[model samples]
Each structure stands twice: as structure tokens, then as C-alpha cells.
Target: MSQLQDNFGRRFHYLRMSVTDVCNFKCSYCLPDGYHPTGKQHFLSLSEIENLVSAFSQVGTQKIRITGGEPTLRKDFTDIVRIVSDNPSIHTVATTTNGYRLAQHAKEWFDAGLRRINVSVDSLDPKMFYQITGENKFDEVMRGIDAALTAGFERVKVNAVLLKGMNDKDLPRFLNWIKNTPIDLRFIELMETGLGRDYFQAHHLAGADIKAQLQSQGWSLDIADIDDGPAQNFSHPDYRGRIGLIMPYAKNFCATCNRLRVSAKGKLHLCLFTESGLELRDLLQHPDQQAELIERLHAQLAQKKETHYLHQGITGVTQHLASIGG
Candidate 1:
């Protein structure tokens, strides 16, 4: 099997595949209210997804992160994990979910070889959580987090998108909660993308500020050598779990990028902040074109931009996080 390397000398080994664009939640930063779902025919079938994963695995993708607007919302969610985990070359399989329905399938997902999970929980306060997610299912999501922990997955992470006047005030509460639990907590800086650019600009909070606040609170932090995607991880002396900061705007990690994204509609996105991609749905429909498709994919990856233009004061990709499989 040949390895896929970009023009910048980065070897791709991870793939984030979105199974569906449909989501139940209407997070203010992700999807707006009354967002329309993609048509069912646009989604790839189970066999097609498996085949695509097989193609990527053959080309040295060892880690597969199943994603979606909400991955568990897909009917074949468990099956998707089972198939991807079955790949001999794929050593790790994980998923990022909103955690609304994770409790019902956590055990099943664990049995299907899923070892890592990232759940998005913005606020611990029910009212604030509802305000941020635009949903009243905070209790359900909390149950889902507990279920993931109870299921005994190797790594269960909590992703909190920090906003200036919103959840940023709850950083202490988040730290206090994680200090007692085994799950790691990651604070992601608000990114300017799609129609949320204005909102992000208005509410964006720098991860550096958050880190400083934590330090001022007497939490000793030591930079840890841990690379999971682009997050800069740090360990606190008082906590059993580590804290992470994903500052895409303040400290971009594009130089060490090693993954690719496949949108739910089968488009191959080389960079999350770029609109350019190669359509692969037609290629997947023909089994005989597998070799050719792989070759084309490699070519497309080779042309990936050296870095995103967000830091240049340019608006990022116009696609919403939901459409991009965040």
C-alpha cells in the first residue's frame, strides 16, 4: 500500500468521515434555526462508506474519526463504526457527537470497537446550556456523557466552544468538574467560518486568555507532548485529567496537519478552512474505479494549500461547521 503525502511533506494518516449532515441540535455557532437537512439520496450507502474507508486505509490512514452534523443521528451509525474498525490498517476509531442520544448506544458502540469519544458540552448550567445549544435537552446530554464514561472507552473527551460573554465565564466550573472526573476537557476558540463569522467575531474568546485565567486561579500547567489533531494539551497538577486548547485563530497548527475530511455528501475536503475539494460520490459508485479513485485522491491531496487564510484577516470557508463535519 502506498502512503499519501502532501506537497508540504506531511503524510496523511487520519480521516474524518461525516456520515450525515442531519443533526437534531441547533447550536448557535454551528447550525442556525430552521436549518434544512440534506436529501437522503445524497448520503453514501454503508457499502460506499466502507469502500472509501478501505481505500483510505490502503493509503496509510490509520485513524478514522467518524463525524457528522451529529453522527449518532444516522441510522447506520454503529454499523459505520464496526466497518471502519474492521479495517486491519485502521488502529483507532472514534466519533465526535453532541451526546444527545449517546446513552442509548454507548454500550453498543463500545462493543463495536469504538475506543475514543468526544462529546460537546458547552455549559454545565442548564439555562446557559439551553441558550447556547438552542435546545432543552441538557439533562439528556449529561446522561449521554455519563453513559460514555460508564461504557469504559479508552478516552472520553469533552469539547467546549468558548464564547466571550457566554460559556467563557464557566471555565472555573468546567475545570472543577473535570478535576474530579476521568474525562479530559478541551476548550476550543471560536472560529470564524460560514455565516457564523459575524457571531464568532462578536463573541470570540482567545484560548490564551482562558489559559491565563486558569493559571491565575493557582492551577499549575505543564505543556504536555500530546497531539490529537491540532489541540495543544497541558496537564494540571491538581487534576487527574489534562486540559486542552484548540486555538485555530490565535495559534494555527496547519504546518503539522495530517488528516483529511470527507463531507457527508462524499466531497473530499483537504482543509477545513478551504472551499476546494474533489467530489467522490460518482467514483465510489463504481467498484472498478477504486484504484483510479485512490490515485485521484492522492493527486488532490498533493495540491492541498500550505495553510488557511483565516490568520490573514480573510473570511474562512463559507461552509458551516455542520456541513464540514466538525
Candidate 2:
């Protein structure tokens, strides 16, 4: 019904929903140090988001991921998850979070129907964490990770946004834990966005750098085959556990890009880094317009550009990571 596709055959059927664009910990890659929107923003009601997903599912889109400024920040997050997961057409129900609140919500989320969790745990060091996230809640975040494992969620992933002069050099420490623990640590290439109109061009971290760092540490690795998505495959030398790299910026995974995003405000974004979005708040508010919303989505998706120019450099990404729903 919708037609957002590149010259490549990959069709955009995945939906990355940003329930709320407000995050408690403002990470370097997510938001600028002191960036703020001029006007007050409103979040999409639970019903509004549900209707949009229901419409998308009716069309061939099967994957749905709940993203956020921090998804847990939403008071009705569990209710929202239940609505989408309850839909038979939705094969996967996942979320990308900061993990600051996962410990308390993991069990509830698992019971509600979230099968996959991708949490952003940048570094283990308290000092570095404070440096990266202008906050001091590392302990809480870790607690959430432990809780997620205990909650019975089968696929638990750790997404680390590798930033230059910040956490990239600490790969050995991160990967070391992955080798011992039964968790999959995903190393994401630092993306440019919201607070990143400038500033981060020189600090960009690429997937090659991550690979090189692992090689230098003599950490034997193998590319992982974690179903499908952007992240390049990588695995622990011998352990059953694995690691992933999402080089969406430099390498341009746009060829196999099959994802779409709906913001908390109800606008649907076909790509992560751009400003173009189709407002669905009204369509969701009006049931009769669901077809119109679906048709608009197809048209917008067909217009998806090749790659994101976030940081505005050879390897820069054009959009903000936080706004992109990670």
C-alpha cells in the first residue's frame, strides 16, 4: 500500500516508534549539552499511536520497535506495548532505552509482551558516565540491565554509542564483559543529530575503528548473523555470545534499510536523520482516515533519501540520534 524504497529492492516495512522524545539523561550523541525546543511539545496519546501501528501492520509491516527520549519515561508505556504486541501481524516487539529504569520495568514489560530489549549503556566507569551523560545514575542503569536478564526477556542487547575521546577506547572492557556474561553488546557508530548541527564532525567514531580496537586487543571475533537490521555482524571468538556494529552513518546501510519511525507527536519518519515526517496524529484521531495515513506513509517512504548527512562531514550523520528514536 506504501512505496518508500531505494533503487534497491529493500522495502520499508519496519516501524521504529518514538513514544516520547524526552530523555532523562541527555547523552552527547542524543542531544547537545544545552539544547531545548522553543515551544512546549505534546506526546501522542496511547490510542493515537496504537491506531497508526494497527494500520501499518494491516499493510505488510511486521516489525515494531518502541523507542524514546527514553521509553520508560512514558507512564503508560506498558499499555502501549500491549496494544501493539497483541496484534497478530506484529512479529517482533522491541524497544531501545537508556536502561536507567529497566530494572523495575523489565518484569512488567516482559509480562506485557516486549520480547527484545536494546539498552544504551555507554561505559562502565562512573566518572566517564557522568562525563557522557551529565548525570549520576549509572548504578540505576546497571540495575535495570540485571533486572532485564532476570525478567525472562529472551533477546537482551546492549547498544553502546561509541564516541571519540569518550567511550570508544574502552572497547576491551565492554567486550570483556560480553565474553563472560551471556549478553550481546552492540557497538553503534556515533551518529549526528539534534544537538549535533556542528561540534561532532571531528569526533565521529566509525565501525572500522571498533574493529581495529578489537583486533589490537587480540580479541578474536566473528561477524554475527543476528537476524536482519543495520548492525554489521560480529561474534565472540568462541563463546556463544556476540557483538554488533551499526555503521548507519559512514557505510550507509540504506540499501537494506527496511525501517520507519513514528514520533511521540504522531509524525511518521521514514528515515532516522532527516526532518521530513508525515503527521499521523490527525489520522489516528480519525479512524476513517486510516487508509489515507497508510497511503501517505507509502508515498513518503518512496521518497526516502539514500543516506543521512547527520554530522555534515565525510562520515557525519545529518539527523539527531535522540530524535531518530535510536
Candidate 3:
């Protein structure tokens, strides 16, 4: 099998594939105006996804993270999980969701073969959660988390995008809440996208500050696996839960890049802020085309840049986080 490595020698073993771009949440920093369909939303079909995953699995991909506006929105979500988990080479099959459907479908998803789950829970406070996500389903989402735990998902994670004056001060609250929850609560630094320029300016917070605070309070860094996501995880002896920080703005952040993203439309994104994507939908038409698809991916991987130019204020074609399952 050909290794997925770039010119910089960064090998990719993880794939973040988006099943759809139509997110239901209207998060202030992401889809503040809510999701509006521009035209026919031609997301990848189940067969196409099967072929795509098969090709990636052939080329040393060990972990797959299914992302979307909210991947659970798809009717075939469970089937998606089942097929992805069926691949022997892919040891880990995970999905990131909004937590609205977990209460009703967590067991079904778990039974379908999904072993890891990450849910977006921006604020612990009900009112503040509504203020950020523009949805008043805090209680329901909480119930969904409980359901996920009951469904035997030991690797549950919650994500919160750190906003400077908004939820930044809520760290202590998050810390206290997760003391015994056994969840990995991650705080992501706000990235500047085409649609969230003004919002980013107002709310962008340094993840380093939070990491410093965690270190001061005795939270020690945790050892990460080869295919783990970009977050720097930390743990404390007394707490059952863990904390993670994703600092994209930090130096050498891309040195350990191990994941590649494919958008819902089957466009391959070498980087989160790449100028454009390489189309792969046509290659996914048949399972016989697997070799050609892998060839295309490998050829493109060689051209991957050393690092993203986010510091230079180039967000590329990504208008918002929901557009490509950020």
C-alpha cells in the first residue's frame, strides 16, 4: 500500500469526510443566518461514499471522521457508520454531530458500529447556549449527551469554539462540570473564514492562554495516538474528564498534520484554507475506479503545502465552518 505523505514528510492516516453541507445550527460564529439552500444540494450518495472510503482505506487510512453541517441529518447515517466501520483497515470510525439526535439515535449509531463521537456544545449555560447556537435545545442536547453515555460510548467528546468575550470566561464552569463526566471537552480557537471576518475579529481568543491556565492548575498533557485529531489533550488525576485545546494559530501547528478533508461534494481539500479543491466525484462512480482515485489522491498529496497561510489572512474558498464541516 502506498503511504499518504506530503513533500514535507507529513503522513496522513486520518480522513475527515463531509457527508453534507446543510447544517441546521445557526451558530453566531459559523452560520449566524441559518442554512439556506442555494441550489440542488447534490451531496455524495451512499454508494459513492462506500467507494470513497474503500479507496482511502486501501491507501493507509486508519481512521475516518465523518463530518457535516450535522452528519446525523442524513437518513442513511447509521448505514454510513456501518459501512465505514466494516473496513478492517480502518480501526476507528467516528462522527461529529450537533447532539440533537443523540438522545434518540445514539444506541442505533453505536449498534451500527460507530465507536467514537464528538458533539458541539458551545456553552453549558442554557441561555448562553441558545445565544451562541441560535437554538434553544440546550436541555435536549444535554439529554442527548446522557443518552450517548448510556449507549456505552466511552470516547465521547464535546467541542466548544472559544470566543474572546463570549464563552472564554466560561472555562471554570466547563472545568467544574466535566470533573466527573468522563468526557473530553475541547476548546477550539476561532479561525477567520470568509463569512466570519468581522465576527472573528471581535471574538477570536488565544488558545495558548487557556493552555497556560490549564498547566498552572496542574492539568498535564496526555499522550496522543498516531491518528488522533489536532487537539492537544490534557488530564488531571482528580478529574474523570479531560481537556483539549486546538490552537491553529500557534507556531508549527501543521507539522503533525495527519488528516485530509473531502467535502460533501467530493472535493478534496489539502488544507482547511486551501485556495480550491480537487474534484473527485467522477472517480467515485464505480468501485473499479479505486486505483485511479487513490492515484489522484496520492498525486495531490505530494503538492500539499508546508503549512496553511491563515496568519496572512487568506481563508481561501471556505466561507464558513458549516460549508466544509469545520
Candidate 4:
């Protein structure tokens, strides 16, 4: 089979598969109102996911990043990880979580074949973390990170959304933490989603400022791998850990697009900010649908725009980051 290449000649090999849309944290930029179920909740079954992943793997997908509103909320989360990691075509299996369950399940998840982990730790200060996430589990989350490292994950990553007034001054603390922690810390620019437009207006910070500061302080840019996400990685010999910046608003940001998203409900989203997703549940019913599924995926790649309209304040149908596991 040919690679999953788009008209622009960008070959996609990374898949961000969402297993559930239910998140526990109430982050201001995402689900500040918390998660509320709409209609009868029907997520894809394990069999359906296996079939979907198998189809993606057949079409040159090598890195599978299991995502979610909170993927660990599902009882079968480890099984989901094992299924994808067990695929011979898959080279890496990763997941981004809130780290609420990491202290308890990190070892098992690693044993289930998960190799890389990204934990969402927006702030280092306990009070500030609570203010942003509406959860007072800062200390617990820190413990979870230690647990992840102990569970045999080589280098764990922590993601923080750059909020203007909230946790903005915590950067020094983060730097101090990573000085000897060997963690890969990333700061993501605040994005304007349909649900968080007002919040974004109040707290959107450009990641470039942080990037510039890092450069001035002796950090050097590192070349990205084909399967890596949008982060521009940086490193310094003095520091044990590395820093990454994800500036979606930067010019030609989508020029390096190499990943695709699949919602938990079995919809293939060519881009995170696309207005509509192609319904794929109909084609995920059986193993025989693999060929048709791959064909459908290729067909949708043509519809992917050259870039997202986020610069123009357009957020498409994404109400919040959690809706599609952003």
C-alpha cells in the first residue's frame, strides 16, 4: 500500500487516536464547565478500535498517540494501549494524560506496551495549578511524574498551556524543576476554541516570546523527527531536561503536518480544527472493511486545508479542546 500522503506531498505517519471524550479536569481553557454527556454516549468498542488501528497501520501509520478528554477514564485503557503497541507496524505508542492516575497505573500501562508518556502539568505551584485545572492534585501529579520515571519511561514530557495571568509567572519554577529532572517540558500557546473564545481573549500568550527567551539563555533548536508533533524542541547542555515550544500561530505552521486525528466516536478528522469529520464508524464494523477504511482515509486527506483558520479567529466546530481530544 502507498503511504498516507496528501496532495501537498506531506506523508502522515502519526495517528492521534482518542478513546474517550470524557475528561475529569476542568481546565479554564478547555472544559471549565466540566464534561457533560450529550445524547446517549456511544464510544467505539475495543474490536472497532482494533480494526481502525489495523487499517491505519496498514496505511503507513507508525506512531500511535492515544489521546482523550482523559483516556485513562476508561476501564479498558490499558487494553487499548496493548492492542496498538502489539501491532508490528507501530514503532511507538504514547499517551497524554492529566497524571491523576499515573501514580497508580503508570507501571501497568508501561507493562501493557506503552513506551512514551506526556503528562499535563500546567503549573508547578500547587495553588496556581488548582486555579487553572480546578483540581487540587498538584502534589499527587508530581508524584505521578516520579512514578512514570520509575515505571521505566525513559523521558516523560509535561505539557502546559500558556495562560496570560494564570501560571504565567511559574516558568522559573518549571525551569528549576527540569534543571535536574530530565523531563521534556513543553509550553503550548493558548488557542482560541469555540468554547474558550472569551477565555482565550483574556489569556492568550504567544509561545514565540518564550522561545526567544530560551534561545537567549543558551538553548538551541533541535531538528524534529518525521513523526514528531508541532513542538519546536530545544536543548541546553547545562540543563538535564529539554524545553519545547508549540506555536500554532507561527507562519507555515501546517507545512510540517504529519499526523491525523480519529475521534472516539469513529470520525476521522483530517485536521484538528476542521469544521466537519468524516463518519468512519460505518466502515469500522468488521475486519473486512480495512481496505475500504484506508480508501476513505485517503479520500478525506484531499479535504484537509493547507492550514487551520485559527489565525483569523475561526475555531471550526471545536467547542473545546476536550471535544476532539485536542
Candidate 5:
């Protein structure tokens, strides 16, 4: 009875829990300029987050990922991973970070039974780095990536957001970097989020053009199947690891999307693109209403949009990417 299967006949198994709306780095594509952080009232306590994740586990939720403004900014990050890891039905507990804090937090989270780590690093150029993230700490991110490697995160994946005129020219370089190093690389097409499209309007490089660029570079990569999550993975012919691509405009995967996002404020979002969400903060107040909350959640889940509408993140909601839980 807990199974809320989607239109694709796939059970929505993965829960992307956004721990906090506080991110250290404000990337141009993600948050843009003048983006203010969220207040404390919007955040869910460690206990509340763990309790909800635990309930989802009872209903056959096996995968949970912690995201945030930057998940590492949360003090209880490691505990969140630990709590989810201990759940019997939860097969994987992962987090996607900006990697700035990974240098210190990597081993701790890894020891807490975290299964995977995804780092968002769009470009390799340091000067371009400043223009993109408004932060001169690109070196810190690289160091963090190395730390994750040293911490036993054998397959740390790098998420690169591709823009038509901006970093799209570096597709060859990204592939070469993967071929040379042990790190995993994935290309993400830029979404016209309310904040992103408003400030940044560079042409969005299509997926086919991206594919052609890599193929023309003579890179032989194979596709990897890691659920219907954003990235469509591709591996080099003789490489040790693979590369991934998550296309929004060219190839939207909303059809097979089994993702559910929980905002930092305790709102359970059934679809990333849709503004509709079920509030869990009120439900948490009356613990007796837990079953009612679950039923409401299931109803919302079934109505998960086939995919996100492309006018971008114009929900009139002020929640930034940090609060959106990525």
C-alpha cells in the first residue's frame, strides 16, 4: 500500500532531502547575483529530517540523497548520513556537494556509511571560475575533489553545467580530464531557472551538439544506467570510469524521473520542475497525523508532472537553490 508508482510504472524510490538552504558559494547558473540566503525558520531539524526519511523507508524507500545550499554547510550532515545508512531498507545514502568543504568533511561523511558523492564543478578555468561562481576558491574545490579521492570515494562524479557559448567549448577538455584522472565527469544542460535565466541568457548547448563534440574528439564512451536520475552516463572505451550528461532542454528525462525533493523547510516536493509541494512542517507538529501525511504525500506523488515546465523556477516562491535542496 505504500508503493506510489509513477506513470512510467517505476516506483518512486529515491528521496532527495535538502538539508539546508545555506550554500557558501553562489554560482551564476544556480543562484546568480543578489541571491539572499534563507532564514532559520525554513530549516528542518536533524530529528525531523531523520523521522521523515525513516517513514519513507518503511514504505520501501531504499535510496536517499542529502543536498543543500551546500549539504556540507549543515553541522548535522554526517549524522543525516549515519541515520539513513542504519535504515535496513535504505540501500544507498548519498550527498551532492560543491566540494569546498569536502576536504575536511569527506572522511567523516564517508565513515558515516555514505555510498556516493556528486560534486558540482562546471568549468576548469580559474578566471572563468570567478565569473561563474563569484568565488576565487576554485583551488579549494580541486583540493576537495582530491580529498574525496583520498577519503575512499573511489568514484566521485563531477557535474559540469554546459552553456552554449561559455564552457561548451571545453567538452573535449572535460572528457580528456576524465580519461587522465580517476574522477567521474557529467555534463548538465543549463535550466532557465527564474534566477538563472533572468541574469544569464547564454545559448543553451543542445545535447546532440554536446554528443557530437565529444564523438568528434574521438572519445569512445559507454552509457551507464544509474536509475532515472539526471545524468545519462557514458564511459570511455578503455577508461577506468565514465562521463554523464543530464539534458533538460535537448533531452528532458522527466518521463522516467523518480526523484522527490524535500526542501530545507520540510516541504516534500514530488517533482523538481513543478511548484506544487506538500508541507511536512505542519504534519510534523501533530505527530498523530503521520498516516494522514503519508496519504497526502502519496496522492501528490502520483500527480508528479511528466517533467518540469521550462519557464524555469518561477514558482513566485523565494526559496533559492540552497533552500530548494538542489
Candidate 6:
């Protein structure tokens, strides 16, 4: 089969699938405090998910990243991982989680063929963690990080979303924590997703500022050769692990975008900020119609916007990061 490419000539090789939208932590920037999950029936069945993965694989998707409001919240999360990993065309199977329950399942997930894990840890301070996530599980999350490293996964990444006057000051703490460990620490720019408009307005920090701060602190950083997704990785002279920056605003990497997202509800989102998507759940239920669905998906990809206008005061399409599988 021919490789899938968008109109802009970027080849699609990565797929991020949201297994479920249910989350335990009410992250200030991700989901609302009173957010409710869709009915169980709304989620794609295990068979449906596998079929979708197969279809994507057939179209040249080489890497699959399983995401969710909290992926580990799903009962069959491991099964989903196994299904994606079993695909011959899939070279990597990774996941991004809140790390609330990773300690209990990191070994299981690794056994199920999960290649890497990215844990979201915005704050090392317990009080700040509670304030950001509305949960007092900071200790548990720390344990989860330890568990992931112990599980011996190929790569363990710690993702910290930099918010001005929020967790931005915690950079030194993160650097100190990861100095002896091999876990890559990534600082992500605050996105203007619609759900957190007020919070975003109050605390959005640019990635450039964070880099400057690190440089001023006498940390020598050199660009690392690893390019996993959109993050621009850098290695420190004194630390064992590398640092990454995902700057959606300050440095747009959309020109080389090569991934597509599938919502838990089975919407094929061509871009993170796109307001429209092609519904795909129904097509998964009918194997005979998969060809048509693939064709439609390609057409949709061709129509993907060249670049997002978030820096120009455009609000993100999806209401919350959870809904879009962030």
C-alpha cells in the first residue's frame, strides 16, 4: 500500500488513539472540575479499536500512541496496548498518562508490549500538584515514575506543561530530580485550548522564556538528534537525561506534522486545532466499508489546515484536551 500523505506532502506515520475519555484527575487545563465521561456504549469496543488500528496500519501508520483523559482508567487498557503492538506495521506502541495508577500497572503494560511511557508531572511540590490537578496523589505519581523506570521501558518521559506563575518556577526542581535518572523531561508550552481560556490567559508561558531561564542558570544545552513527535529535544552537559520543548506557539512545527488523532468516540481529527472531523466509529462496525472510510480519512487529511492560528488569538477547536485525547 502507498504511504499516506497530506496535501502539504507530510507523510503520516503516527496515530494517537484515545481509548477512553474518563479521567480521575481534574487537571486545571485539561478537563473541567465537573467533567463527566461519555456513556460506556459511546466508547469503541475492543474489537472496534483493533479493527481501526489494523486499518491505520494498512495505511502506513508505523507508530501508535495511546492516550486518554486517563488511559489507565479503562479496564481494557492493556488489551488495547496489546492489540496495537501486535500489528506488524506498528514499530512503536507508547502511552501518555497522568501517572496516578502507573505504579500498579507499569510492569503489566511493559509486558503487554508498551515501548515507552510519558507521565504528566507538572509540579514536584505536593501542594502545587494538588492545586493543578485537584488531586492529592503527588506521592503516588512519583512512585509511578519510579515504577516506570524500574519496568525498564525503552524510554520514560516526564511531561510538564509550563504555565506562567504556576509550575514554571519548578524547572530547577525537575532538573534536580532527573539529574541522576535517564527519564527525559519535557516542558510543553501552554496551549490556548478553549476549555481553559481563563486559565490560559492568566498563565500561558512561551517555550523561549523557559529556554532562556535554563540557559541563564548555567545549563549548557545542545540539540539532541532524537525527534519523537513535535518536541525539540536538548541534552544537558551535567544531566543524564535530556530536556525537550514542545513549543506550539513560539515555534510551530506544523509544517512537518505527521500524526493524526482518533478520539475515544471515534472522530478522526486531522489536526489538534481543527473544529471538524470525520466520524469513524460506524465504519469500524462494518468491515466492508473500511475502504470507503480510509478514502474519506485521506480526503480529510488533505484538507487539514496548513497551520493553527492559536498565536493569533484563535481558540482551539475541541473544548478540552481530554476530548481531543491530549
On residues 1-326, what C-alpha lDDT tens digit does candidate 6 reach at each position?
56778777888888999988888888888864846856554788898898899889888898899998788988889899999989888989999999988999999999999988999988999999999889899999999999999999999999998889888789878888878889889999988877678888899888988778777866665653322588777777788888888898864568768789998889998888866668888889866777877787777777888888777888756778888687
TM-score of 3: 0.98
- Note the residue pairs that clash in candidate 4: none
- C-alpha root-mean-square deviation, each candidate: 1.9, 2.9, 0.8, 0.8, 2.7, 1.9
Residue-level lDDT for 264 in candidate 5? 80
lDDT per model vs. reference: 0.84, 0.75, 0.91, 0.91, 0.72, 0.84
Candidate 2 residues 251-310, lDDT tens each? Answer: 556666777788778887666666557777878986678788777776665667776654
Q: Which stretches of candidate 4 lie over 4 Å from their true place?
A: none
TM-score of each: 0.94, 0.89, 0.98, 0.99, 0.89, 0.94
Write down the worst ten-residue block by lDDT for model 3: 316-325
Off by over 4 Å in 1: 38-41, 215-227
Better of 3 and 5 by lDDT: 3
Error of 3 at 17 (Å): 0.8
> In candidate 4, what are the lDDT values of residues 31-81, reduced to their tens digit?
888999898779989999999989999989999999999999999999999
Query: What TM-score does candidate 4 reach?
Result: 0.99
Better of 1 and 4 by TM-score: 4
- Clash counts for the predictions, in order: 0, 19, 0, 0, 4, 0
- lDDT tens digits by residue: candidate 3, 69-126: 8999999899899989998999998999999999999999999889899999999889
Global fold similarity of model 2 (TM-score): 0.89
Model 5 — which ten-residue stretch has the worst lDDT?
311-320
